[model samples]
Target: MVGLQSTEHAGDNCTPLSDERGSYTTAENGFKEKDATDTHEYDVYGDEDTAEIKYRTMVWWKAAALMLAETVSLGILSIPSAFSSLGMVAGCILVIGLGALATATGYVIGSFKLRYPHVHNMADAGEILAGPIGREVLGAAQVIFIVFLCGSHVLTGLIAFDTITEGASCSVVWAVVTAVVCFICTIPRTLNGISYMSVVSFISILAAIFITMITVGVNGHTGTVTASAHLTFAKGFLAVTDIIFAYAGHVAFFTFIAEMKKPEDFPKTLYTLQICDTTLYLIVGIVVYAFVGDTAVAPALGNTGQLVRKIAYGIALPTIIIAGVVNGHVCAKLVFVRIFRRNGMKSKHMNSHTFTGWATWIAICLAIWALAFVIAEVIPFFNDLLGVISAVFASWFTYGISGIFWLHLTPRSERWTTTKQKAKTIFWSLVVMMGALIMVAGLYASIVSIIDGYKSGGFPGPFSCVSRAL
Candidate 1:
């Protein structure tokens, strides 16, 4: 497989490649634009032997599918509870406003990549900003966030199964089933392969949500709701965190952008996710809350009538399993690629099928999924867990990290030569502060909520066979 090569051409604007980091040189200006072909950072991401075949092969649409599957998780259904906590007024504001912010920050990450094309993951990006310590910290955080996401998927799949079956079997049984299926689905060697399953995953979610909207409209039963309301600080922040979870795909953005056929097309795919997810979140949150009011469950399908819920959960089956599959694949792929790339055991030059490479990859996938399954069985409050996830991971991955990236790539910190530069600096500083607020406050609220759950016995024990739907 031939990797792309964009060498410098003879032009007056040429900037010679030197010891500099994060230079934005374009092909038209005769500066050598970094490609995955020969960079050490690229090799650290994946060895050159198998790089062309495994990475940098996805089109924008397939990339969107993988991203959509990752970003738009069970969190979409949690938005209505947010509406109930803060009413529709603040709820919509948080959803749309934070969503726009998430989008803008996402663009910052893309810009960082376009400028420094060698970054393959958050660790690499972090190293650019704060050296080796940053790499270790961000790399661990990336794995944690992805692993937690996989666990959330496992938990949600259990809920879907339990809702459909009405607790006919042990809850642990359903969870294990979900884990096994997710593990099997994650065995595909590439995101391009996973992208195929992502199409079905998207359709599954769409069908389930529509079923919910239609059935709720036809056979309506509702409690009182309001467009204006107030919430305690902890409660409001929790709701905001849920909205943040809806756009928590940034952690994987570098990975996704690295694989795209043309990384510039990333925003198109990002917009695809933003439009579809935010719109669905708004519609489903409003419609479900209008029908179920204060008692609306996070995955709103459970808020429907008995038969309607079973049908909706049945339709949602693909998404329940496939979304988790997508996340598990990402988590496993990151670990597998990082290890194999370092060892130079790619299939191109080595027999990856023997005990050395393929077996190790499969083992890594299984280990991550198994850990996710354990997470599903523990703690057990869906909304609370999501709040913790958003606060701890998304705050940095989606918001603060990009702000740092922007500042690093911009003019020197102390002196801005122009008004626009100063303004940009001010704007990013706010972005960073806002992220800090979410991260700190979000953690506090989530922990308090969890404590409250334990006090009220609202939480379940780990590996409980009892149904979690109640």
Candidate 2:
């Protein structure tokens, strides 16, 4: 509130602040002037008037917990399987290195944006760099990404529940139970409330990891764990990119940043979050590999070894189910919010206590859930294609956007004059190119796999075969 002054007269385009307490319009420069007495008590995110308390409460633990929770969703289980496809040594190394590079890039971009308090989200950055088209494209991509992500999560939860209870007569009952529980846990929470759930999820995932490590350690490092002889460097690299999908939730960091009371503190917290995520990923990959080895590591542990694998599978299955549900609900809300607002409904207007809003929310959830069920039943290979598509889009949104940002924001005077800035530009350029290449390759691979599956009743090449085997 200390720095809460109007920038409307500063020549920046802005919208009026809307709230029940007070309304303040902004000028073209995105600044607004308001009387102290008429100033709204709530934060920009529409949370309660506890700025001082909230700012103090966002310690390192909360930030890390949020990051960990978001990172560990359905991606975790899929990561090991992805790695197994590329062979142990190559897969492990690629996952760690790519994750580190991608995460570092996110941190740099996030930090740069945080330095300018005016910038709120990726859309804001896009607008500053490229204009109206940038904002629209980025916003649409983000909203669509969130919707697909949520839908995928819902599908994963439903499928896993069905898989786990395959022979049981009560499988249908369990599926309904899962959907209800996810809705209860996810709906009707403020952004901060979701963060708390994220913290709990983080803890639950870590516990699962601990269980895995302990089981592997107790079992000793002897099994069918040899690397595949057919794995080439190219295949390994692609596998690394595929596995990188596991760490593709950097966009969710924006949601966290929005909730932060002290936006300035976000950079350090974001870095900490990435560090913790990368560390956990490396540790988990190593532990799982050490436990099962290369040859034995399959898509689902049920296909590998029986007793120990089943134990690991049991621990992982529940964690995935919970994480998937949460991810779906969060994603569902994001898409729902965007669709509603685009249609002229405000966030406050979408209260569950209101019949219209509540019905809308329920309708959206049921639609997504039903779609997931249909996809699960009809297309057995949908998950593989979903993972690839998600990765390609995520890479484009992150790498392409960052590269464009650097290109536009860098001053003409310093284009080739300053070594540091020039180097930064070159680095981002390469990142953009690599990301584009990966996107193309992933799409090609996914399409080919689908076609091959249709023609031959089996996966096409090694990666597809490995994906199916896993």
Going through the candidates in the order shown, the clash numbers are 0, 14
Give the TM-score of each candidate.
0.88, 0.74
RMSD of each: 6.4, 7.5
Candidate 1 lDDT tens digits, 175-259: 9999999999998777788898889988888898889878877768576688877777887788778788888888888888877
lDDT of each: 0.75, 0.54
**How far out, in Å, is residue 452 in model 2?**
3.4
Best by lDDT: 1
Q: Give the TM-score of candidate 1.
A: 0.88
User: lDDT score of model 1?
Assistant: 0.75
List, residue by residue over 1-470, the lDDT tens digit for candidate 2.
22223323222222222332443443222223233345433333333343221312455456656666666655565555555666567666766777767665666565545433334445545555666676667666665565556545544444444444442434334445555566565554345555566666666566656765666667777555556536544444445555666777666655556556665676677677667766776676666775666533324333333454445445555455445444555455555554433211134433324565567777776665555444443455665567566656777654555565555545455556657667776787888797787777776666656666678765233212111111
For candidate 1, give the lDDT of residue 464: 93
lDDT of 1 at 367: 97
